[model samples]
Target: IVDRIDDNKDGYLTTEELKNWIKRVQKRYIYENVAKVWKDYDLNKDDKIAWEEYKQATYGYYLEEFQDATDQHSFKKMLPRDERRFKTADLDGDLAATREEFTAFLHPEEFEHMKNIVVLETLEDIDKNEDGFVDQDEYIADMFANEEGGPEPDWVITEREQFADFRDINKDGKMDKEEIQQWILPQDYDHALAEARHLVYESDVDKDQKLTKEEVLDNWNMFVGSQATNYGEDLTRNHDE
Candidate 1:
């Protein structure tokens, strides 16, 4: 990814190169997420999601079973907000959201409410006991359920350790609202900004705000493992291929 963005082929990623790479990363993120949302919610196979279908999929069928007052309140509040969003996205007011509108509606950067909804849904799924928190067991079980049938992967074990170490900040062995927020959206986690800053910080050995091939090679592992680097694995694999 860094090499491709080094458009001048001068063995360095300048500010312009970093900016372009960030744009590509943002585009890829939006494209993949939009496709996933469409696939999951576009019921009736109409290539678009109508208001009713979206409501059914989001609000779920067992609304009455929401014994938790918080969950019930959240769901009720979400209904009108989602309705308004649907109407807003329905550019022609056709009571349906096309892929484009739905994509816009689901953009996490642009629509915070939608992002919250997504986060809440994720919490609900993982918080099986409905205790408004996710315990270590709950997290582990959810991960295993999503994976293919086999013994849990080593990565899952590592993730469990990470959750206990980083996510359970209070040492309570459970994740509450603040912890969950940290898990979902770590502080100052703007991927594009972080990536650009990290590339320059790691590779600009001369403090010139640009990378050279020698500098990048010197810190290759940083690019591969650092959260600040996007598409690093793909770039590595492409090089190998």
Candidate 2:
């Protein structure tokens, strides 16, 4: 519009802008991050950046984060899944994920591995600011957890208070890790390992194949699974009298 080449200002440029700086200039501006501010202000495309039809397009989240998903699954993941999923879930137009919507739908259980990596006490601790919700970054740090002093600091937490906090979901001081995991994510968890992470023996726990079975599932529910039967058996056998 500033260039006045479109003259009509119908949101899209004419052949002049297309054949010239339109593509080159738009890309340059987008890359420089100047256009990031006015991202949703497409001024023409109803606030959605349809890059393919564009000559140089100026919006999109960082794509590389999900590049691996594209290689293994579908290229459509290159864009935000929420953008599309939002329309389906919000077919009625309210802009929030409701309880009915939440229970009816589900977050991906793809990375069961994450649960093992993210411990219960660690999660409770991460809600440190006491926000009741934990973010991905807080989940990464062992901050919500005290270093396990009795034995493995990296793998476990030795603090009694911390462990107690794990069971006390409402911070009410009652249940336990098993109860917490059960009430939080899974709908009908029962067995000890029911809510644990499903880790492949070859890939994890026995990363170097040295730790005893007790050490494997001993850390968190996320790392233990039926698939890890051998590792679990080893752990159970270790406890045998």
Candidate 3:
């Protein structure tokens, strides 16, 4: 990873280079997922997946008679949701999805054009009253349970203040679609840059605001989770008998 991201070839990983590497990794995951799932749905192998093709591929099992009524009910609910998302992602309105459109459909949060859909979906999930807006109580309830009938935690109080002071930008008691979008997908936030900076901050023992290959390797666990090291699989398989 260090060798791939060290763009300057000065044996150091700068913040920008690391951020680019992380962004590349994210894109790679998206592309790989799309590739793995495309062949299953694109039965004709013409490089485009039609709406009928997708519906049959995904919901054929539900169409079978062996499924229970509860399963049928779930399929009925999910079918329209999937249709809406598929149509939104089909930019050409041809009712078919190319590789790019399929990517957008599968991971709408990764694309700027799909952000409104993301915001709308979030509101639909959180706005219990269906009033087309999210009030303070709804926002708090989404994050905290308080099932014990006890006083709110300090962090919950801080979040409520955050919602009033920052999230509800127009000082409205409730958050409209625009405010919900801003709250969830702030334009100023760069996830890759933030993660890169955090890794450097935690791993750069020399305090030079950059990282050497040795530093990254020394803090490998901090850079990546157990997936990279096989630590999780090993722990599960090698537990005391």
Candidate 4:
């Protein structure tokens, strides 16, 4: 992600480059959501949704069936967020959201609250014993659930190692809140900042606050490896054309 955004090829991402990279990532995030939102809410296949359509589609039978406290709380919170988003997206106050307006409403980097929800969902799926945490066994089992009979894949092994070395702080053989926080945001530890800071920190070798191609090459493993960096796969999968 950083390399592709380094437009001058100076091996470092300036503030402007980082901003551009963030914009691209945000756009991708919004793009992915566009189809999903439309599919679920555009009941008439009109490619546009009014507030009532969105409300009905989102809160209809499917969601109402899961009326647990968590689900209820999530639904409650969603309304306000969506309302704000709708107002932002409804550029002409047309009381309807077009695809373009809906896209405009989504701010990807500002979705840290959603990240917590995702983490909770993942914990729910992986915590087989319902113990409120995931042990190494549970983590590995969930990650490699699709594998048939072969030895674990290299990526899975690397993830296991990371689970122990990085995520298992205090060596309790399980993850805790602090560890998960570190896992999510390791650097300045601020989830709101652009993720490009992490890439810059890894490759900036000279203490001059900038990087060279050689510096990036030297840290290739850190940039490419799954366990080492959060943005690696995103960079690889969404590289600029």
Question: Which pairs clash inside model 2?
Answer: 125-144, 196-221, 197-221, 197-222
Q: Tell how far residue 225 is off in model 4, in angstroms.
A: 8.5
Sort by lDDT, best first: what order? 3, 1, 4, 2
C-alpha RMSD of each candidate structure in angstroms: 9.2, 25.4, 5.3, 9.4
**Is 1 or 3 the stronger prediction by TM-score?**
3
**lDDT tens digits, residues 100-177, model 4?**
766655542244434444455456667888888878888788768855777878998899998998788889998755
- Top candidate when judged by TM-score against the true structure: 3
Q: Which candidate model has the greater lDDT, 2 or 4?
A: 4
lDDT of 3 by residue, 79-184 (tens): 8888999999999999999999999999999987788889988998899999999999999999999899999999999999999999998997999999998888
Query: Which residue pairs collide in model 3, if any?
Result: none
Which one wins on lDDT? 3
Worst 10 residues of 3 by lDDT: 226-235
Error of 3 at 171 (Å): 1.5
- Candidate 2 vs. truth: CA RMSD? 25.4
TM-score result, candidate 4: 0.48
Candidate 2 per-residue lDDT, tens place, 11-63, comes to 43333432342334333333334244334333354443322212123223334
Per-candidate TM-scores read 0.57, 0.21, 0.88, 0.48
Distance from true location, Cα of 216 in model 3, Å = 1.3
Q: Per-residue error at 23 for model 4, in Å?
A: 3.3
